[model samples]
Every structure is written in structure tokens, then in C-alpha cells.
Target: MGKLIISVNTKEMILKSYEMGADEVVISLNQCSFNGLKKISLEELDSNIPVSIFFNCCIFPEQIDEYHSLFEKIQSLKIQSIYFQDPIIILWAREFNCLEKCIYRPETLVTNQMDANWWYSRGLKSVSISPLITLEETLHMIRNVPNSECVIHGHLMMSYSKRYLVSAFTNHNDLPSLRNNYDLTIQEEKRDGHMPIYEDENGTLIYTDFVLESFNELPILMKKGISRVFVNGEFLKDEELLDALSIYKQIMEEKDVQNQIVSFFEKYKETSYSKGYYEEKTIQ
Candidate 1:
């Protein structure tokens, strides 16, 4: 069976998630104040689970000094897989001879099969499909790259930027909050929907109006040989994350757990969830 991979930023989750049936780990520090790079050096002690560092901090091509420093850190680490959002960082990865360990996450936008194959040919292990694509496009992606990953659950990242929009308006532009994921959120004026917004070193990031719940589609994904799943637990409390993890674990492990999982969700109506683009054939 395909394994479930959850993205986390805490030392506790980094160590315990695999115990909860997470087949692998994606350590995301973008949402936290702690230096994730340093934290990985200290806490990445568990060798049983495959761990990938989620690097949202991408630099400009002209930043040669920064690239040199980053490459040194990359070389010093024992990790092999890295989930990064910078297209330009590919040059740094190649220079450091670590391109094969890179899993390009273009939260900048979605990607397709042709794009996945293109990157695979270049040396990247795999790529993430855009959350905005249609179910048909999603099928084509997994069929094309059997090892490619897609976000199956969590709040979908709608947008990202280098500027902190919140701090700009709050008169705290000079001070980037170094706390855990902030509580600031934005709601659409036209509709009764809201998206979670947070800021850190990488800059401002926005999430979808509703949680992306594709639990019912697990059967199709698993049957198609889709190998990996990206789960988000950075914002969830311990109990909430465990419960969410349990639901996905059942869906992947059981053949006839769809109805039960649906019932489980119906019983817990805590988060307003949606199927997103799962029902559509293509994005318009």
C-alpha cells in the first residue's frame, strides 16, 4: 500500500507522527519561528521514517553568498529528500550534487504530468500537482509519475508572497512575528468564506476558504498507484491532528472504509470542508 506523509514543524510531531502511521515526514518550519534548519540538526534522530525538509525560503539567483552558505548547511545535514518551492534553487541543488533529493513544490502554482516528467528527467525525484487542477488532471498526473505526490487533505495553500501584508497594515512592518502560526485570517467580501493567513521569514501565505477534504477519493488514488500523500498538521492541535491522521490512515488501509469515513466526518462537523476541484474534469 502507498504510504502517508504528513508535514510537521514541531519536535514532538516530527518524532511521533511516524508512530501514528505516517509513512514519512515533511518538516515544515515556514509556519514556525524556530530555525527549522537548526532544529533538523538536533531533532532528526529517528531513522525509521523517511524525512524530507520542507524549504519554502527560496532566494534570488544573484544571491551568491546566500547560496554558498545554504549549500554548506545542506551538505552538513544527513537528509536526502528536500521539499522546496524555489525553481531557481534547482541551480543550487545541482551545484551541491543534491538534485536527486529535491522534491519541487511549486506552491507558486500547480503542475502537470509533462512538467513532472520534465523535472524528473532533470534529476528531481518528483513534483507536486497543483491543488487547482481538475480530477482528470490529477489522474493524469499520478498515471504519468507513479511516485508523484498530491495534497489529499488539509487547508489548501491558495497564495504565497515575499511581502508580509499583515505587518504592513498593522504598523508592525518592521517586526516579523516569530511566534507559532498567527491567528490573522481574511474573509472574502463577496462570499461567506475566509482563508487563513500567516507570515514568517518566507513571507505571507494564504490558505483556502475551506479545508480540502478528499477522504472519499482515497480508493481511486490508491488503486491508481499514487504513491504519496501530503498532510498538513502545522496548525492543528494534538488531538485534532491525531484524529485527522486516523481518518486518512483508515481510508488508505481499508478497502471499504469510505462510507464509514464519510459518517465519521459527518459526525464531527467541526471544520467546514470541501472537495475543492475533485468533482471537476478540468480547471477553467
Candidate 2:
């Protein structure tokens, strides 16, 4: 069976996930990963479950030396894998001789088996199946790629920019800067729901209006030989996130697949959960 990997940012969340029977927990490296998720030091990652470090920022020339130092420090730690998006990480992973410990997660890029195999052939541990692809495309990659991973649940990131768009807007308006505000959100001119938007030192991130739920698809993914499944805990209340973790864990353990999915759907019927692009084709 594929292992369950849940991204977490706190020591408390780590312990809670461990107690809830999660196979592994993901934590982003301080100042190194993207998204508005809280970052942590390697020291705070002490826990029973295996931890994967998210080193996902696009590297700049000036930050090369700092990245090198951080990579050196990570070598001594007990990390299951490193989820990276930047090609700069590829160089550092090779230099550190830890190519086998890396997982390429370029968000929306790994859409075909050809590209997925290319990265796996280059020695990455695995590559995340892009969330924007259809289920058939996802299953194809899982069957062909040796150790593919996918995100089963969470708010999907719609866009990420290196420019501080939120701060730029605020500054231009001469209003109080809400650059670091996590509670800030935005709505499109024609869109119905308010999407969460935040700006930090890394950049600004915009997420989808609805969270993506894959309860109905998880069983099929497991049967298709997927290596790992991720449940992102971002933008969720603690109890809600924990409940999700518990339900997915239950679905993995229980024999009645249909019943489990139905129950899971009924539980979160109120919340805006979608299959996203999993069922629909982007073209035609």
C-alpha cells in the first residue's frame, strides 16, 4: 500500500498527525520553500514519523551560497525526501550526492509520462503528478513511473509569483501595508468565492476558491500502484484538517470503499470540495 504523507508546519501538528496514524509528515524549510505556509528549522522536526523537507523556492544568484550551506546542513538530518521545484535544487542535490532523496514537484508541469519518466531516469526519488491533469493522465503516470506521488486533498495553489503583488498594490494605494497578513484574501471581478492571497518574503500566492477532495479517487489510485499520497493541511482549521487526516486514514484501512467515500463526502458536504481538473479535460 502507498504511504500517506501530510504537510504540516507545527510541532503540535506533527505530534497530532503521528498519533492519528499518518505514515509521514512534510515540513517546509525556513525561508527556503514557497507558499504562505509557516516554515521551521531542522531542529523542530524531531518526531516519530518520517519527515520530508520541502525545499521549493526558486533560487537567485545571491542566495546560492546560503542554499549550499543549508544543503550541507540537511545532509546530517534524517529526511525521507526533499520536494523541490527549482532546477537549482537539482545541482545542489547532485553536489550533495542526494539525488535519490529528491522529489520533483514543479506544480503543473509533470503532465505526461514522458516528462515524468525523464525526471525519474535522472535519479529523483519521484515526481508529483500535477493536480491540474485528468484522472486518466494521473493513473497512467502512476502505472508507468516507478514511484509517483499525488496530492489527494487540500486547497490547490492557483498561482505563485516572485513579485510581491499584494504589497505593490497596497503601497501604490498609499494604504497600510498588509504584505505579511495571512488573513488577506481576494476575489476576482467575475468570480463568486474569495480566494486566499498572501504575500511573504518569498512572494505572493493565490489559491483556488474551493478545496480539492479526492475521496472517491483515492481507492483507485491505491489500486493503480501510487507510491505516496499527500494531504495538504494549509488553509484549514486544525480540527477540520485532523478530521480529514482521520477520514483518509480510515478509507485506506477500511474494506468498504464505496461506503467510505460516501461517508467522507457526506461529512464535508458543507465545505466547498471539488475534484478540480481530475474529471474534466482542460481542452475540448
Candidate 3:
């Protein structure tokens, strides 16, 4: 059987993930506020279930001095795995002397078998296989890298760039802009309800819509030998979480292969779906 990994930014969501039948939960330290970090530090993370911290590679470069304290705190919490995007985080992981405890996974390179093999050779225990990968690609990776671990489920990060379009629009010369209100809030008022907003340092807003409602594809992923599934609880509501977990549990409980395939497709058809940045070939 495979394991379900849910990533959350708050203790409330962490507790909610357990109720939803998650095998493990990852706390995203970059998204949480200082108070939130303190709360997690005080909480009982060393319980029956596994609790890991996801350290964003882009945020914690090796050049920064503050990362030392953050690494110390992670070590103190006895966190077993640190999920990261960039290989640079691996340097920090090595500096902390936690090579065994790090999982080097780039969000975009999940489908690249060569990249996965490279990371594995460099001491990465697990790598996030691309969500956009076709079923055939996944099978190829599974066949090639029999020893590597892969993330089967999680919100596919569609686009990550330093460009701030909202800021540029708000600062247009045609309109008289307020001096202090540089902040822009971008919202997608669509019925699918999977929009994510990011606020930059200058308070500029960036809208991101990464739809991950792929409960139907679980069987295909499992067939490819994916043992670990990850869900982004940061964007999911309690009801949605329940629905996802229920679907996962259903798949886990079923022994009949024919019934499993039918159940997965039925659920997939019922769930709200979106393609996100991968929907178009051109960059936004």
C-alpha cells in the first residue's frame, strides 16, 4: 500500500489532515508566519505519525546566515525529511549535516528521469515526478528508477517567475496611483475555485491557479509504482480535503482491480477540474 502526504501551513490544518487519513503531514515553513512557526515548535510533532518540514529552496539559499537558525530548529524538531525544489538547498542540507534527511525534488522536473537519477546519485532519497507527465512517462520512470521514491499527488505548481505583472499594471502612467497603496490584489472569480494569490515584497499581487483535483488518476499512478502521494492542504478546504481522502481511502480499501478502475474514473468525472499553466503552450 502507498502513503498519503499532506502539506499544510497551520496546526489547525495539520490536525485536519490527520482526521482525513493522511499517513504523514509536511509543514511548509516558508509560508508560515513567525507566530505560526513558534506554535508548530511548541506543538507535539513527534507523535505516532511522521511530521516533516518542507523548506523552500528559493527562500533558503546557502548565502543567508539566518538559515542556520532555521536548520537548527528543524533538527531540534527531529524532522526526518526536508522537501526542496533547488539543488542549492542540498548544500544547506549537507551543511546542517542532514544529507540523509533531505529529499531533493524540483516541482517542474518530476517527469525527467535523468534529473531524478542525478538527484538520487547526489544523495536525494525522493524526487517529485512532474504532475504533467503522461502515464507512459510515469511508467518509464518507475521502470528506470526502481529504487527512487516519487510524489504521486500534490498541487502542480504551474508557473514560478520573478516578474510581477500586477505591479506594472497598477503603476501605469495613465492613472493617478496612490503613493502608499502599491499593493495589488489579484483574484480569479471562476467557479472552479482553485486560485492562489501571492504578495511580493513590494506588496504586488500575483495570481496562480494550480488545479490538483486528480483523484481519478490514483490507479494509474499506483500502477507506475508510486508509493507516496502528496496533497497541498494549503489551498484545500475541509470538505475538499475529506473528499480527496475519502477517494484515496476508497482506492486503498478496494481489492478488485476492475472495481478500482471504475471507481476512480467515476470520481474523476465528478470532481471539478482545471489545467492551470500547462493548459497553454505560451507563457503568460
Candidate 4:
């Protein structure tokens, strides 16, 4: 059977995921500041299920100590593994002598043998398959490297950048700063004698007809030997989450592999949609 890895914030989602047939749950500490880490304790995550924690934020060199502390706490939970994206974090994972417990680059796919070899040299055991790749591309890459694990299900983050897109908008408007909540917000700007330009949270300027929906590409993903899928809870609202979870659960329970894949793609076409970068193919 294919695996499901759900990214969660609160404990409620963690418990709900198990009930929804999730194979694993990863707690994303993306927005938590250094001070916020004090609130989460190792005892809180001591559950029977397989849980992994991930530092999804952009890490700088100055934050090494905090990262180390976070890794130490994660180790204490006896979780299966933890994931990091930043190169510095990967280096730190190796420096701390905890490379065995870490997974690298969750949202990007490795297309060539050189990329795969580079990750292996860095002590990376698993890498995420990029959502942008077609199902055919994913299969070819996976077949090339049969030993590496792949994240099969989850919100495909369109982009990752250090710039705070939200802050730029508010600053331009002379308004108070907004908290980083991970929701998609639009920013409008009126140029001299021109129409107002809109920007999303990632600072990617949006056109009027830009697409902004998630896609259901799981059926194609499953056939590619994708054992684990990481769903981003921070991106979906409550209703969206329920809808996605239901669709995912339905996909997982079906016994007929070929038939299920067909059904999944059909239902996914209705549920998953993408806009901006994923749709436009424009990075910035």
C-alpha cells in the first residue's frame, strides 16, 4: 500500500489524521519562533504512531543553536525521522552527528543521478518528489534510484523564498504588519494612471486570471513508487482540509489498483487546482 504523510500544527490534526488513515504525521515547526519552541515539550508527542518533525522554515547561520535545540528535542520524542530544507540545516544535521535521523528537501524532486548522489553524500536517506514533475517524469526518476524514499501526497508548495511577501504589501500601504499565518492573501497596488496590481503572500504578482487551486495528482504519483506523501495543513482552511482528507481516504481504501488510479484522477481533477507559479510556470 502507498503511504500518506500529513503535515499538522495542532494535536487535534495529528489524532484526526490517524483516524483518516494517514500512514505518518509530520509536525511542521515552520512559523514557530525561538520563543515559541519553549511551549512544545517532548512529552506532548510521545504517541504510539510514527511521527516526524520538520523545520520547514528558511534557516540562517545565526539560528544554528536554536536548530540544534529543536533537533535535540525531536530526538527525545523517539520519532522515526526529522526533515530539513536549508543547506545549512543539512550541514548542521551532519555536524551534530544526527544525519541518520534527518530527511532532506521535501518539496523538490531529484531529476538526475548526480543530484541523487549529492544528497546521498550529504547523508540524506530520503528526498521528496517535486509536484511540478509529470507522473511519467516521477516514475523514471524513481526507477533510476529505487532505494530512495519519496513523499507521495501533500500540498505542492509552488515556491520557497526568504522575502516576506506579506510584509512588503503592508509596508507599501502604510499599514500595520500582519502575522505570518500561511494563508493566501492578496495585496493591491495602484500605479500612476494604471490598474491596481495584486500580489500573493509569496510576493508573486498575480494577474487577474491567475489560477489558485490545488491539484489531485495522487494516482500518477502512487504508481511511481511514492511510499510517503506529506500534506501541508497550514495551506488549507478547515473546509478544504476536510474535503482533501476525504478524497485522500477514498483513494487509499480502494483495492483495485488500476481502477482506483482512474477514479482518483477523476475525483482529483475536481478537487485539486493550481494558480500562479504552478499554473503560469513563471518563478517570480
Best by TM-score: 2
Model 3: lDDT of residue 32: 22
Better of 1 and 2 by TM-score: 2
TM-score of each: 0.83, 0.93, 0.71, 0.68
Clashing pairs in 1: 110-130
- Scored by lDDT, the top model is 2
Lowest lDDT block of 10, candidate 3: 30-39
lDDT of each: 0.67, 0.83, 0.56, 0.53
Per-residue lDDT of 1-284 in model 4, one digit per residue for the tens? Answer: 66666666666677787787776676745332211111234466655656777665565667667766766666546576666666666766666667766666545555554676577566665666554554555566666653445544334444444565656767999988664433343434643211112232323321222223323455554665555555555444444554555566666564434564455456556444343233333233
Q: Give a tens-digit lDDT track for model 3, residues 115-202.
A: 7777777776676666665556666786676444544443444455544444456577556543223122334575544444443422
Off by over 4 Å in 3: 30-49, 59-63, 147-154, 163-195, 200-210, 255-271, 274-284
Clashing pairs in 4: 152-228, 153-229, 211-275, 213-273, 213-274, 214-272, 214-273, 215-272
Which residue ranges in model 1 land beyond 4 Å of their true spot?
Answer: 30-50, 61-64, 74-80, 172-181, 255-263, 281-284
**Higher-ranked by TM-score: 2 or 3:** 2
Q: Give me the runs in candidate 4 sitting further than 4 Å from their true place.
A: 30-49, 91-98, 121-123, 147-155, 187-220, 256-284
Q: Regarding TM-score, does 1 or 3 come out ahead?
A: 1
| Total residue pair clashes for candidate 4 | 8
lDDT of 1 by residue, 19-136 (tens): 8788777765332212212234333445444566765565655665765565556555566577776676677788788887778777635466777777667778777777777677
Tens-digit per-residue lDDT, 1-284, candidate 2:
78888887676787798788788787877778787566777777654446778888888999989987988887777778898998888888898899998999988899999999998888898899899989998998899998899999888888999999988998999988887676877888998877889788889998887888887788899989889999887676666777778777877885555665576667767668888888889975
Backbone clashes (count) for model 2 = 0
